[model samples]
Target: MERWQRGDGRLIVATNAFGLGIDAPDVRVESGRGGRDGERSEAIVVMPAGRQEELQKKIARAKARTQPWKIQSRVMRPWETKQVEWEKMERFLSGSRCRRIYLDSEMDDRQDRKRCEVGEERCDVCEKDDAMVEDGEARRAAYVEEQRVIQEQAAQAERERQGPWVDSGIDVPSSSRNIPVPSSEVLVPGSVIVTSPQPFTDQDITSSEEEGRPIPQSQCSSVSFDQGFAADHDPVGESRMFEAQKQQRSQQRWRVEADSQREGHEVWNLETRLDSW
Candidate 1:
């Protein structure tokens, strides 16, 4: 145990790694001393686990010696102590005066004191009650005003759609009968150019001029065999390529089937070996 002075008060703190079993009477000072800020924040006092472990071991050894002894045991388990500490922390944080009053009524064990209120030693919250209530009311009023603005905007949009002129020529029917397009328009293959009013190539000769290919004097009609090769026949060396591709595909399928069967057998053997082990 070591003593230090802070806030003009002497604070005795335990750093001895174990409880010294000190029995000071009239302990006006709080236990867990470096804990003034921590008390306000509801944090735990972090004592090392060395002493707690030793205490548990000693208790276990004693219990082992008296295995058949018949006496009722009374001990505060860790969970019970934690619950008491948590309850104390919750009461300390609660903001309502009514809640604090109820807590005070429940835990005031000393009959010497009538109540926990201090005219001369007030807790921090007792001095600031009025401001908290005012802030809460202000926030509620602002929320109600924001909701009113959204409702007004929605109503205005509904009225605009109900007005007249929903049938005039300017209104434009939703059906295709009101839409206008020239009858000559039609889709032609290999080019997006419009061919209705005149031949599409009449509009431009620059593409042909750049390529230096004379536009074949408009052949009124003949399937141009020179344009592309016939699909049924292959040229010279290309005829044998198809046979090689077919053989390769057949070999790949055989390898895949054999590997799958080998994997299945290995899995079955592994399961059987594990069962024997």
Candidate 2:
């Protein structure tokens, strides 16, 4: 046992009578550790003839509070109370349906239990059940994965339809119609575009010019304010808004830039440019 624990021994050839039956924590860890590299592997527990009967006899004797011939080691405990852990182990070893179902039923009082399904790695009983299954396991796995992805997409769409705050799991009010999009999109040179954030687009400059109404990157304001609106705050007495090229939004100090040119970056930001006579 020490050699096995220390990686010295490669194989363990013995009955798993104590661990698999009564000791829940000790069972399956070593066997399951084989497929750690994400490859297909199996952990099989072999039961010899008359082994279960022997285990049953021992369990019965223990349940009856009969004294053993010799004192048990520290690992095996004396009957502290009527604990049903031993019985659970017995049922687990002898379960017919899904192994996970049995385990979950024990762990949580779960009535709506699920099996291994088509895509998952089957337990021993499940493998035996589908010994002559017509459908390929690989196909089943793919179908299961696809279903999961579809579910995630659906969840995201639901959140988006509700609101941005819904996706953030906050109770603050926000517009579902005007969800945020990227602002730092590149445009062609000589495209004197307006970045009024209502709706974002990538329309050709020439096409827009020919259309008579040059469509801007009209992504109207999408905000996630703790205690504020989309537009800036304005005071009643002081009117600093629209003083120059810059405009001070209502109820806010931050200045909205009409246009600013950086090195190798041309930005044309305005609401709409209608030639008024």
Candidate 3:
């Protein structure tokens, strides 16, 4: 076993004595009647029908050998325990119940009713039978899907409860007056300062007011600053600017639809535009 652990042997085939005190993490496959790490390990026990009779005969022989009064008490206790273990093994091998359930019942003293009651995948009996296993798999899949949907719904509810400005404490800006104009120079790495064509000046605002026509909010909204980490330096200003741009676009869309309706033209729809294209 030590040689196998040290990579001297790739495999080892021995009795139950070889497994005791062995702590090899990379031991993938082990075959024997006993000893396990209670992990994803496989234990295959091959017990012939005649083995029970043979074991009983051996126990009888041992008992007869130790029948002398002096050693009877010392030997009898261990032999009795072995007899009980043998009977349990025989019952497990012969039982028609799930192999895993049977093993759990014997090893951990767990009740059969509680073992794998909620869509366990497979066992000796389940693998041999197809219809029952398929039903169990379908139920497990549905249960997993249901749990995922519930989690997603809970996350959506939390986001809705928190609202749009959950991360930043600043409220969403509503108009062009609150929007911050981006500077010409990049203030942070990977930050692009997008400037609009025909920049809005005080003169332009005055001219629009004199003409009795409000300057479309979209003009101010088009100038957005990608400040990146610089936003952390001034979170309030950054959030206000982002919110103002968003509101400007929304208001501009509404105004466009209203203007189209006044002119007796159908509102610009994606399907109509695509059809024309």
Candidate 4:
């Protein structure tokens, strides 16, 4: 005969479903399961004023013959399972301080293993779920750091690979009368200079004259231009600049997909926009 919030209530010393249609403003319901020898209590039935005593006795008897309550257990959601496996994979792949932090969050019973350091408990994802939380978090952090290092190394290598196209302080067209020496160099950074190669027109003419050969009247029919972007020739820094810009666009696209779950956009698409070099 009262009103209360959804889960708050007072103790009821009754026998039949203590809070059946209960709307008490303040109540704390407790079962006498331990105190009594499984005996019925005074609050076992609703004392309806007009009900016959015989009917009430019959209802109580029927209730006593029925089974008791059933309890339900909690289960993990699908996303939770996916996230855990992903973090596990991260821990396996990581190799940095970040990985250590993630691992400290995942495995709890590994205190004896000394898998994680002691003082890393204060990080962002480190505080939850105690020991396992710290382990998993450490693993993720390490994985992230390793992946970052690998990416940086790879990028450095790529730049090195593109080195030959940059200037290397080598003499090009400076020694006009000398026979040009052939270099054994593969492309590396700082090989090619931003300035265009010196024109070979006079050299070509001089060589042709010396060889008693006449210049052809027309350009060759089978020649074609390669429109590829060489990392060195780009005074505008298109390759590096555009690549960074593309990365930003890709991150933005990913964020949008996360929010809306829509398709038709991708990071690789922005990266592969080298049609015009």
Best-performing candidate as measured by lDDT: 3
**Best of the candidates, TM-score:** 3
Question: What lDDT is reached at residue 225 by model 1?
Answer: 28
Which 10 consecutive positions of candidate 3 have the poorest summed lDDT?
223-232
Per-model TM-score on C-alpha atoms:
0.26, 0.27, 0.31, 0.19
- The 0-to-1 C-alpha lDDT of every candidate, in the order given, reads 0.49, 0.54, 0.61, 0.47
Q: Which pairs clash in model 3?
A: none
Model 3 residue 254 CA deviation (Å) reads: 79
- Regarding lDDT, does 1 or 3 come out ahead? 3
> Which has the better lDDT: candidate 1, or candidate 2?
2
Overall local distance difference test of candidate 4: 0.47
Query: What is the alpha-carbon RMSD of candidate 3 to the true structure?
Result: 23.5
User: In model 1, what lDDT does residue 88 have?
Assistant: 52
Candidate 3 — which residues are off by over 4 angstroms? 28-40, 47-77, 112-115, 129-277
| Model 2 per-residue lDDT tens digits across residues 1-277 | 6676666866777764523533322334445343435566566667887776776676566678856566446455556323557666665576445776765676557768667666567777687777746357767888999999999999889666644432243232334324456465457589866453344445565678888984554333444332343533334312332332122122123322322233214322222223331
